[model samples]
Each structure stands twice: as structure tokens, then as C-alpha cells.
Target: MIKLGILFGGRSGEHEVSLVSATAMIHAADKTRYRIVPIGITKKGDWLLYDGPVEKIADGSWEAYALDCLQKDPARYSIAILGTGGRSLKDTADFIIPAVHGPYCEDGKLQGLLDMADIPYAGSGVTGSATAMDKIIAKAIFKDAGLPVGPYVPVMAEEFRRDYPAVKARIEAQLTYPVFVKPANMGSSVGISKVNDGSTLEAALEEAARHDRRIIVEQGIDGIEVETSVLGNYGDLQVSCVGQISYTADFYDYEAKYQNEDGLTLTIPADLPEEITAEMSRIAKEAFLALDCCGYARADFFLEKGTNKLYLNELNTLPGCTGVSMFPLLWKHSGLDFTQLVERIVELGYERYSITHRG
Candidate 1:
């Protein structure tokens, strides 16, 4: 059986979300085919080896248990074993699946560490993770690749701090009212706000700058939000059926996405014209390749209400695997169950590693 390390509980605003996602994946993974090693990273950035009830993981109690175990037997539970030079992460698990998101977890930092340790991990490499995590960079890449992206303005935290009026004027000059202010490198809507007019733009930008040095204010697309899943390596990719998110909140903010379960509804194989679905699938695959992404990713898009024009929103390299997440649901609709989906991701990771590390 393959020794699989499920890394979770990252040092990110999405830490709790990552815990939930890891729990879901741990339950769905086929135990017969893989020996699961639960690795938890505290918000303080401490890594521990956890071997307790999976329920404790989501409830945030696993950390205490892991700490207790470490205190009792430091050599056995210490994550130092994952360090370079001796008995590294490669010796602990044959493969790693980071069920984590946001900054340090999904923005290529963690992937870079694993790469240096020669550990094969699921999802995109460093470039794909970093690019996809930064909305500003990903938008530029998409636009350059001929993908339709909505109007937006990028703001540097320094610029906003130095000349607030200048930044606000620049943004207002480019985008109309009802724009979305978001941290360039955040996910799960952790630091995002929908501003209706200039009156609220300052507060929105302030909230965004609190999360990232780079901020993006995008012209809100008055349209339906749809997403599709892409899986496989560059030469061999598969796009799943499109799914739509219908939310009742001001927007799909953090609360709507994870807290208020009833605030949104997910429609799989979204009821759209055949041509539109095909076009979305085409664009999804294109965006995946444009980022040189491997393993699996979810491409989000906006279908304009009036023009019916589609705009590439962004791609999530390590999309949530929680029960309510659209990534797994879209693949489920495409005929791959949660277990099969996890197994396929492992296969892709190994596939990429073997191809790239060949002698």
C-alpha cells in the first residue's frame, strides 16, 4: 500500500477550512490502498504527526492530542523527521496530498519545500500554485492567453497606504460601481468585499490590504457564477461538466461559503445552452494548460447576464475537497466518485514525478 501523507491545518486564514477539507478527504480515501499519515500544521506554523480520531481534526482538538504525544515521545512525533539530510518527508510518505489552502499553503511556498525534499505532492507545481493563487497575476496570464477576463485594477498595499486618494481615484476611473475588492492571494473569500459605490470602496480596500500586499478590485460581473473541474497532466487533460453557484448573500463571501450552508445552492451539469457549456469546458482546459498545472484544478467563470459573454474568473490549483466544495462535486457529476477522485489525483502526482525525474 502507498504511504500517503495528508497535510492539513495550514498557517493561513483558511486554516479551519483546511482542517474540514482534510477530514473529508481522510474519510473518503481508500484505506486499503493507502496507509494514511495525518500531518497537521498549527496556525503558529508547528507541524505535528497526528494519529487520533478523524473527528478531532475538524473540531480543532487534534492539535492538543498531537502536542501531548510529542511531549511524551518527542523523537517519534517530532516533524523534524521531515527535515532535509536524513529521514525526510520522502521517508515518511510515498506521496503527499496537501488538503490545505491560502497563502503559505497554496501559494507555492509549501510546494517548493516539498520539491526540494524530493517529495511528490498532488496538485500543481510551484509556478502554477503561485500564479493561480495570485488573482492579479492569473488574470494577466489569462488575458495574455486570449481568455476573456473582466475589467479590474491592481493596487499595491504600499501605494494605497502612501496615497489613498490617488489609489481610489485610479480604481474609480477604471471600474464602475459594484466592484469586488479582494486580496490577490486569498481563497475561500477570506478577505473579499463587494463595494456598491465609492462611499464603501475605501473600507473594502482597507480590508483587502489587511490580507495581502497585492490587492485587486474587479468590476463585478452581473452574471451567473459557474465552475468546471480539470484533471490530469499537460498532454492528457479532462474537463468535467460545468456547475453553477446560486447564492443569496451580497456575494459568495466567507460566511456564505462555509458558515451559512443554506446561503447558496450548487447546480451540477448547469442548465445552460450546449454551446456555452462546450465553450466553458474549452476555456477551462485552456486555462489549466496556460498555468502548466498538473494533478487537478477548478476553473471559475462568469456568464454575463445580458451579453451572454463568458469571462475567465480564476483557477484554483488546490481547490477545497470539503463535502460542499464544487471541485469534487463537478467531478462526481462527471462520473468520478470522491474515492476515485482522490485515487486519480494520487496517480497524477506519481505520473508527473516519474516523467519529470526520469534518469
Candidate 2:
């Protein structure tokens, strides 16, 4: 059986969400096919090898029993495996599936570490992860690739502080009210706000700046939020059926995404026209390749009601992987169930590693 290291929990605002995703993955992964080694990372950037109940890991209670899993003064990236008689043996993983989301974990930092260790892992590589995580860069790439994207203005924290009025004026000039203010390098809507007027512009920008140095103010689309799942290597990509997310909030913010979801509804194979669905599938793959993502990613879009115009939103390199997550659910509708979806991602990881790490 393959020794799979399930990496979870991270030093990000999305830490709790990561724990949930990790717990679900741990439960869904095929035990007979892969031996799981659960590794938990604390909010303070400490890595621990945890062997406790999945529930504890999901509730941030596993840190109490966390043990150092790294080799002693190791020149290379290696993990310590507990052996008989309480002895620890330095070993390397056959493969790793990082259920981490946002910042230090998903913004290419973890991928870089694994690359340095010569370890195979699921999801995008360093370049793809970094590029996709930064909204400004990712939007530029998408626009350059001829993909339709909404009007957006990138504002730096220093600039926002230096001249709030000018920055606000510049934003108002290009986009209308009800624009979305988001941290350029965050996921799970951690620092996103929907501004309906000038009164809330500064506060929204400030809220976004709290998460990252760069902030993105996207013109809000009066439409539905939909997502498509893409998987596999570049040339052999697979796109899942489209899914629509309906929430009763100012927008799909953190609370709507993870908590207080009484008004949340996800419609799989979104009741969209055949042509629109096909176009979204095509555009999803295009965005995936434009970012050079591998293994998997969920491409989100805004479909304007009445007009039927679809605008590409940012792509998520490490989208939530819970059983109810749109990524897996869409694939589940496309024929692969949750367990099969997890197994396929691992296989894709191995395939990507073999091709890229060939001597």
C-alpha cells in the first residue's frame, strides 16, 4: 500500500476550513489502497505528526498531542516515522496530499518545500499555485489569455493609506457601486466585502488590506456564482459539470461559505443551458491551463443573469475537498464518487511527479 501523508491545518485565516477539508479527506480516502499518515500544522507554523481521532483534528484539539515528525537537524526534507520500542526512523513519503488552503500552505510555499524535498504532492506546482493565488496576477493572465473578466482595480496597501481619496476616485471611475473588495492573496472569502457605495469603500479596502498587502476591487456582477472542477495534467484535463451557489448574504463571504448557511443552496449541473455549460467547461480548462495548474483546481465564474454572459473569476488551486464541496460534488455527478475522486487525484499526483521528476 502507498504511504500517503495527509497534510492539514495551516497558519492562515482559512485554518479551520482546512481542518474540515482534511478530516473529510481522511474519512473518504480508501484505507485498503493507501496507508494514511496524518500530519497537522499549527497556526504558529509548527508541523506535527498527529495520530488522534479525526474529530480532534477538525476541532483544533489535536495540537495537544502533536509530536515532532521532522528528522533531527536534517540536511534534507524528511519525516520521522515512529518505530517499535519508541524509536523514530527518518523516512520519506511515497506521496503527500496537502489539504491545506490559503497563504503559507496553498500559495506555493508548501509546494516549494515539497519540491526542495523532492516529494510528490497533489495540486499545482510552485509557479501555478503562486500565480493563481494572487488575484491581480491571475486576472492579468486570464485577461491576456483572452478570457472574459470583470473590470477590476488593484490597490496597494501603502497607496491606499497614502491617498485614500485618490484611490477611491480611481476605483469609482472604472467600476460602479457594489464592487467586491478582496485580498489579492487569500481564499475562502476571508477578507472580501461587497461595497454598495463610497461610505463603505474605505472600510472594505481596509478590511482587505488586513489580509494582504495587495487588494483587488472587482466590479460586482449582478449574476449567479458558479464553479467548474478541472483535474489531471495539462494536455489531459477533465472538466466536471457546472455547479451554482446561491446564498442569502451581501455576497458569498466567509460566513456564508463556512458558517450560517441556512440560506445556502448548491445546485449541481446548474440549470444552465447546454451551450452555456459547454462554454463554462471550455473556459474552465482554458483558465486551468492559463495558470498552468496540475492535478486539480476549481474555476469559479460569474454568469450574468438575463444577458447570459459568463465572466471568469479566479481559479482555486487547492479548493475545499470535503464531501459536500462543489469540486468533488461536481465530479461525483460526472460519474466519479468521493472516494474515486480522491484516488484519482492521488494517481494524477503520481503521474505528474513521474513526468516532472524524471532523471
Candidate 2 on 1-359: residue-level lDDT in tens?
Answer: 88788899989999999999999898989999988888888899867777667888888888775643234323332334333222222144568899999999889999988877677899899989999999999999999999999999999999989999999999999999889999999999999998999999999999999999999999999999999999889889999999999999878888887886686899998999899999998998988999889999999999998899999998999999764578888988999988998899999998998988998
Cα shift from native, residue 260, model 1 (Å): 1.0
lDDT of each: 0.92, 0.87
Weakest ten-residue segment in model 1 by summed lDDT: 79-88
TM, every model:
0.98, 0.94
lDDT of 1 by residue, 1-359 (tens): 89899999988899999999999999989999999999999999988889999999999999999999999987777666346533356777889999999999999999988887888999999999999999999999999999999999999989988999999999989999899999999999988999998888888888998899899999999999999989999869999999999989988888888888888899998999999999998998999988888999999999999899999999999999887899999989899999999999999999988887796
| Pairs of residues at least 3 apart in sequence or in different chains that clash in candidate 1 | none
Q: Candidate 1: list runs displaced more than 4 Å.
A: 81-87
RMSD (CA, Å), each prediction: 1.2, 3.6
Q: Per-residue lDDT for 319 in model 2?
A: 94
Error of 1 at 269 (Å): 1.4
Off by over 4 Å in 2: 67-92
